[model samples]
Target: MRAAGRGGPVTRAAVLSAALAIVDRDGVEGLSMRRLAEAVGRDPMVIYRHVPNKAAVLDGVAEIVFAQLSVDVKDSDWTAQLRVIARDFRALALEHPHVVALLVTRPLATPLGQRPPAVVRPLEDILTLLTQAGFSGETALHIYRALFGFLYGHILNELQEVVERPEETDEVLRLGLHRLPVNEFPLLRELAPLLAHYDGAAELERGLDILLNGLAATL
Candidate 1:
């Protein structure tokens, strides 16, 4: 019943998936080796065989989250590829808001090169896309950083705006926008109807067009 580094790679993957399920349902805080084992029907001690520690579990969860992003760079031009990747990434983050928090913050805790391969692959793909499209090594990294930074920022902003908000009401008062001082925030107050129907994907597309076009024109 105890897994002491005994599970093979497939077993480890299954354990990681179970860990992800726990994160989706209960958030990262609710994920413990014991909890993972319980979710996967293993002894609490057994999960450690698959994952060395809590840190590894978190990293594995991050790896699993990253793996969900499927970007097809081969089928399109650089701009189109990037658009697909950007939209796919934002969609995945929205799908798993709790796991996305881990995805966004884990880089602070672990170095990029030292991260798991799955976790690092998306960056590598982007860098490849840029290099193939004529960006030099240094320029590619810079562009990747700028692009990913905006993507990450957009994901966080979207989560904050949409995650905890109540179901749409016909009126803005239900969104608590009515609480703001009308004089101090006249435009935002007046735009409540538009804000009530926030479309993150559309805004992200518009912003990306600006960012990517600006990059193209600049470089």
Candidate 2:
């Protein structure tokens, strides 16, 4: 047990900040109440004073990350606002790759009211944006769902892309696409060059263009 120091009391924000750091360096599994307390220079039991348990800590870490997400409910063009959000969300995910899992899955497990305020704030703001743009409450909810579903899928796919041999000059070798049997994956192997040099931002924009166009047709 270490002292939290004579500087100040152990605040929730400080605890969560330390937890986020541990996740950033070592992923979710690296965090524990004991480790968190140690990071903040407090006894393991003292950590319970700020957060109930590891689950709460996880929620807090996720909340801290999501608190940085900016949403403008007053943005006149809902489509353009969504575009900005999509790009910003992508950048946030990239900034904290380890926390992406939490951002995506935490809300699914927790009920809307039970989730952190910061986590739910964006949902309320987006709904407000669409409804003010003349969409019905139900329609606004659907639009929010549709947009986030696409964004979540896109971010997950982008993050999973791995270059087996990044230094390899040959595109096929760079992506390890050459290892596939020629007969079974001819097209995939042929597309090795494209796969090796993926542009996530461009892909996101193309997806948004298609999605927004199709969604607009529905209204």
Error of 2 at 42 (Å): 1.0
Candidate 2 yields a Cα-based lDDT of 0.88
Each model's lDDT:
0.79, 0.88
Count of backbone clashes for each model?
A: 2, 0
Give lDDT tens digits, candidate 2, residues 1-219.
122443568888888888988898999999988888888888878789989999889898889888999899999999999999999999999999999999998877898899989999999999999999999999899888889999999999899888899889999888887778889999988888888888999999999999888878887
**What TM-score does candidate 1 reach?**
0.86
lDDT of 2 at 32: 85
Q: What is candidate 2's TM-score against the reference? A: 0.93
lDDT of 1 by residue, 116-196 (tens): 888888878888888878889888888878888999888888778742246646445646766778888888777777776
Give all candidate RMSDs, comma-separated: 3.7, 2.7
